[model samples]
Target chain A: MSTAKQPDPARRNERSRQAILDAARELVTEVGYAKVTIEAIAARAGVGKQTIYRWWRSRGAVIFDSFLALSEGAEGLALPDTGDIEADLKTVMRATVAEFADPGFEAPIRALNSEIINDPELAAQYREKLAGPVDEAKKARLRSAQRAGQLAADADLDLALELLYAPLYQRWLHRSGPLTPEYADALVELTLRAFRP
Target chain B: MSTAKQPDPARRNERSRQAILDAARELVTEVGYAKVTIEAIAARAGVGKQTIYRWWRSRGAVIFDSFLALSEGAEGLALPDTGDIEADLKTVMRATVAEFADPGFEAPIRALNSEIINDPELAAQYREKLAGPVDEAKKARLRSAQRAGQLAADADLDLALELLYAPLYQRWLHRSGPLTPEYADALVELTLRAFRP
Candidate 1:
C-alpha cells in the first residue's frame, strides 16, 4: 500500500455525496424527476453506480436528498423577529417570493413538488426531514409574535404559516399569477388582518 | 347494410368521448400520471388511437379534460347566496374538503396535480377551463358579502379566493394536515375575519 498516495476517505466520501446531489438536482431540472435515474445520476456525477446505491435507497431518496442538501445551508434558518410581526413577516415572505422567482430554484422546486405529490412516502419524509425544521423556525417567530401581543395567543401557527405561504406556492405551482414582492406583501397584510390579536 | 339499425354518428361520437374520459381517469388512477399513455387509454376505452388524437392533444390534455368532465355538471354552479357569506363559504369549502377526500376523486386528482405542476401549458389550461368558472362563482359570493357590508367594499376578490382556498389546498397536496370539515370551516372563519368590513 502506498501510504503517501492514499486519499482521505472522509473528504473523498463527502465529495462523492455532494456530486451525487448536484447530479440529481441538475438531471431533475433538465429532464424532470421521472426521467432522473440512479444510473444517469451516477454517470453525471462521475461516480460508480455502486457508490450511489451505497448511499441512497432509491431514486426518490436521491432526489429528496438533493433538495435537502440545497436547504442544508438554511437548516438553522430563523425568521427575523423585529417585534413588529407585520414587518418581519413581510420581509421573510418577500424573500420567499424572490427565492421562488429565481431561475436556479424554479425547475428543481417544481420537480420536487411533483415528486412529493405523487409519492406519499417521500411527502412524509419531506415533511419530517425538510419542512418540519423550517416550519419550526417560522413557528418560533410566530410564537414570539404571540408573546408580544402582535398575534392572537390562540393562533394555530401551522395554519397561520400555511395561510401566509400557500397562496404564493399555489400561484407559483400553477403559474396562475405573478410572484412579486408586492404580492408577497399583500399576502402578509391579509394574513395579519385575518389573525390579528 | 342494416340501415334500420344504423346508430347516429353524433351519439357514437359522444359515447366514444365519455368512454375515453372514463378510461383516462381510470388509467391515471391505476398506473399514475407518468405511466399513463394514449395507447392504454385507447385500449381501455375500446377506441382507436386516432380517436383519442382526434379530440385531445396529449396525455396531459386528456387527464385535464377528465377533471373537466367531472365538473361539467357543476359548470353553472353558483354559491348559495343567502346574503350570509360566512355560511355560504363554509358550505362551499367543506364540500371541497369532502371532494378532495373522496376515493372516487383522489388518485386521478393527484395525478392531474402532478401533471399540472410539471407542465406549464397544462397548468394554464386547467386555470382557464377548470378553475376559472369555479373562481367566478366564489367571487360573486364575496361580492355579495361586500354589498351586504360584511367584507371590505373594495376587497381584491382574486386575492381573497386564494387566501380562502390555498391553505386547504397546500395541506391536502403536502398531506401535511387533515382535510376535515372543521379545517374547511376554520379557513372560512379566518378568511372572513381577515377581510371583514
Candidate 2:
C-alpha cells in the first residue's frame, strides 16, 4: 500500500487545539468548572500538558475559548429585521429563552457566568468577547425601530436592552422561575409597550 | 467578681451562635467561600465543629444565616407610599444600587450568590428566605399603585416587579456593567412608564 501522506503539521496543530477545547467543554459540564483542572483536560484530550499550556494560559482561558467556539456555531442572539419590531423582538427573546433552557449549554454557561461575576478580569474578557457585541447589535436594531417611528425617539436603548433580557437571565441565575416561551413573549410585550411612542 | 452572673447556659449558647456566624462571615470574606471550611470557622470562632454542626447542616447554611443576620441590621427595601409612585420606586431602586455597591457586602454576597446558582437546595432556601418576601412586598406596592390609578389596572404586577429589579440583579450576576444609582433610576423611569395609566 502506498504510504499515507504525512499529515500536515498545521492541520495536526488545529486538530489538537479543537480536541483540547472539546475536552474542556466536556469536563466543565461533567465535573464542573471548580473541579476541572488543566491536567484533567490534558489527560482527557490525550495531549501533553505542555501542548495545552502552549495554547491556553489557564483553565478559564481554555473554557472561555470553548464557550466562544460553541456559541459561534449555535443560533446566536441576532435580532431579525422582520419590519414588525414587536414580532422581531419576540422571535429573538424566544430564541434566548430556548438558549437559556438548553441542557447542553446551561451548566457550563452557569459556571462561567458565576465565575465572571466573582472575577473582574474574566468579567472584562466576557464583556469584550460576548456582551459587548450582543449589546451593540440589539441597540442597532432598537435605533432602527426608533427611526421607523415604532418606538419612542428618546427611549433609552441601553435600559431597553436590559429590560428585554434581564428577566430571563434573573430567572435562570436565581432559579426563580421557568425560562419558557410565554415568559419571553411577556417580556417582549411589556418592553414594547414601554418603548411605544 | 460576682461570678459573671453564673454564665447562664442559654446566654452562653446564644453567644456561641453569634460568634460562629461572625467567624463564618469574616472567613468567607477573607479567604472566600471555597477556602472557608467548617474547621477553619470553628478555629476562628474558638468553638468546636460540633457546635457549628448542631445549628447548621453545612457551611452554606451557616453563611446563609449570617447573610440574613447582616441584612437584618441594614436598611431594608421598604417601598414608601409618597403618593407619587415614581418617586417611591426610585427611592427603593436607589437603595438597591447602594446596597449592591457596598464593599463590605459585595464579596460574600457574590460568593453566596454563585453558590446558590449552582446548588438547587440552596437556591430554594435563598428564594424562601430572601427573594420571596421581597417579591411579595414589591407586588403589594404595585397593587396599591393600581388601586390609586397611578398605574394601569391590568398592568401585570409580577412582570412590572421583574422590570424593576431584574436589571439590577442581571448587572450584579453578569458583571457586564456598573450597578450605579443612575442605572437604578433609569430602571424605575422605564418601569413606571410601562405601568402608567
Give the number of colliding residue pairs in candidate 2: 0
Best by TM-score: 1
Summarize candidate 2's per-residue lDDT along A106-127 as a digit string, tens digits.
8788878866877788888888
DockQ of candidates 1 onward, in order? 0.87, 0.72
Worst 10 residues of 1 chain B by lDDT: B67-76
lDDT by residue (tens digit), candidate 1, B10-88: 8899999999999998887787777888999999999999999999888788878997887785658888998778898
Candidate 2, residue A110: the lDDT equals 87
Error of 2 at B17 (Å): 1.9
RMSD of each: 2.4, 3.3
Candidate closest to the true structure, highest lDDT: 1
Candidate 2 clashing pairs? none
Q: TM-score, each model? A: 0.93, 0.90
- Where does model 2 sit among the CAPRI classes? medium
